[model samples]
Target: MPSQRGSARRRQRGVLLAGIAILLLALVLAAVLASALTRGKKEESLEPLRWQGRGTTRNLREIVLGRCYGYLAERRAELGDKDCLKIWESLKDAFIHKNPCNATTEDYQPLMKLASHPIPCNKSLFWSKTNDLVHLYTKSSRRFLTLEDTFLGYMFDGISWCGDPSAPGINYESCPKWSECEGNPGSVFWKMASKMFAEAACGVVQVMLNGSIETGAFRSSSIFGSVEILNLNPDKVSEVQIWLMHDIGGPQSESCSGYSIKKLKNILEERNFKITCEDNYRPVQLLQCVHNPDHPDCSLCTNSTEAP
Candidate 1:
């Protein structure tokens, strides 16, 4: 009887150990499943940034055919075919199936050809690193027209787009950032567009440049610097006005007489285009003063400066 009881106790011990082992296995499986679920959630969170072109294409069409047409409705007679499907096609073809970072100006030749229009001479305004302020000034006063006012530029302003060579459409989420790729879709379009705008420049043209930047008001590598300035026809562009714009607050680092500005003036003069420089161009100063009347510079924002 003692031996049998000992045997029964041993059996009980074995069963208990087996149960513990099974429980541990279940716990491990639960942990693995939980880890997988967490990973899936993390991946799902990143979906928006990598959004493929299927949805973006539709939005692009809407921007080209919808919003842009409305903006150009008043001038439709001058810019024929409010229908922008062909223009959209040309733009897409320029980068589709091509490397996202390998698009060049020539790649956009077809699109440029389709979107070309005669900008009124002397009304053209170019800007570098001052897109927001320039647009606000132009939109409100309507004194100067910018590339952003054009149908092609208006549609894609502040937007990023690129194509995937492996995919058939735009890779909105993973498109290269500006300065990441020299021949990026956005860069190529702007290069071609700036060239055309500069070539069309007539009479006195205005360029709004930021003075606070360490790179100087005129950066030689900027689209305005490299493309626009080089393309400005000396015969058509009688004068090139440099609006060296500064902020209303303190920390003024650059001026119209800065080394960079002098280089820009020399370039224009060499091209036979009369150069003019205005420190804190009047209209821009007025806008800054309007924004910050309490600023110290606001009180001194008089148009007091020697002519170029």
Candidate 2:
């Protein structure tokens, strides 16, 4: 009987040892699984921001101001903080009214201008050297002026809107100095002359906004930005648009990122001017200029909303 009891005890001890081994193996497996899960989570958290989706490229200013004011919360602290707040508040106080349709400033000039101004387009590439242009931003109200200024300077139908070097009144179109190329519509000489005028007007605006042209610029130099139009209500107003034609060399980009629509927006904001509506320049380059050689020359292309 004693020998039998000893054998049974030994069998029980072996079973206990087996159970311990199984438990240890399970614990090790559990630890390995936890580590793997942790590593995966870390990798996911550390992934870099890749702009993989098909969206346009945005300028730094346009991205910051456009996103910040429109979608994000109002009042970013990065800009001239409290002082900016006060300035914006005062500016908006004169504009925002008990009545949405008839708000105006203390000077009454803005009100008069809004009243007298001809049917305003939804968006326009305005040409001005006026102070009224730059006062659109109001951090206190978190409002940004809208409108994308695609190109600056005076853009008239016949002339490129730059003052002629030969004479103040004469432009690229009718320079007596260029009697050699009169009635030539748009000769090579005329095109170059127009470019010069556009560049000069753009340069002047740039100087006023920034201390140096290299540090900052207008038109061609203005890149990747946004402008929030102030007091320009689409519902109350008429037409609005921006020019996006490929008159210059090289292939015109279908997307805004490849172009400087945002940059134009930013430069205008710096000048205290703002615009509303998209700068209508999509990828499909259409010859909409009245001067197009093709049939159905649509010269009446001024701010009629973007075509999807």
Candidate 3:
């Protein structure tokens, strides 16, 4: 009986030892897995930012080349001796293989020079918070030209692009937003373009401001207010005419005599620019009435004695 009891005790000890070995093996496996997961996270964090905004426009090169060729074909007289291939190369070199947020205005100088064309005197139009209406008016009137009408702007008006340090250079997967960084490619390009456009303005220039903007029509931080207005040549640009237009229906929060307009006027006067402000300029209002003919505000010329 004593022998049998001792044998049972020995078996119990063996079973306990086997259980401990299994537990130790499981702990080793868990530690290895945890270490591997940590290493993976560290490597991922070391990779460059992929950016978070809209991806670079699909077929970016094709679109840019197409626009360049189209501009040359349509405006050969204005754009003399421009090499589209050189312009594309300059543009690509501005941001390619670099951090998307590191591109600066100076980097676009070559591209700007390659794509530069003189904006005719008295035809320069600037707009603030009235992008759609301003473009519509320009399209219909064909009297004035905005920055977007030029070759550089025409090529990249709504397109987005950025660069990566990885393969292919250009980040077709994603691009940074203007608000993401001060030196983002898009913001830098537009700033430099706006400055050049304003500097080229000669004789009287027109600015279209949105009267229905609740915060005010003239924002000091806007491209027109900051870059364009500040860069205008006082000697070449004789006058700055403002057309403050409200929406077709109601809520005309601002006007020619409002604080915003007054502020804009003061800025122009300080810069030696002859300023003229008109609320709901008749011509632009007429254009707006084209789409909203049933609106009461569209009855401007209804009582006219003249025949169409």
Clashes of each: 2, 31, 0
Best by TM-score: 3
Residues 275-305 of candidate 1 have per-residue lDDT tens digits of 8888887777888778888877887634567
Per-prediction TM-score to the true structure, in the order listed: 0.75, 0.25, 0.83
After best superposition, candidate 3 residue 166: deviation in angstroms? 1.8
Q: Candidate 2: deviation at residue 96, Å?
A: 30
- List, residue by residue over 66-99, the lDDT tens digit for candidate 3: 9999988988988899888888788889988888
Per-residue lDDT over 182-252 for candidate 2, one digit per residue giving the tens place of the 0 to 100 score:
22222222233233323222111111121112222234522112112222333432332333333323233
Which is the winner by lDDT between candidate 2 and candidate 3? 3
lDDT of 3: 0.89
Q: Please give the range of 10 consecutive residues that has the lowest summed lDDT in model 2.
A: 148-157
lDDT by candidate, in order shown: 0.78, 0.31, 0.89
Which structure is stronger by TM-score: 1 or 2?
1
Give candidate 3 misplaced runs (Cα > 4 Å): 1-48, 306-308
In the predicted model 1, the residue pairs found to clash are 49-173, 50-173
- 102, model 1: CA deviation in Å? 3.0
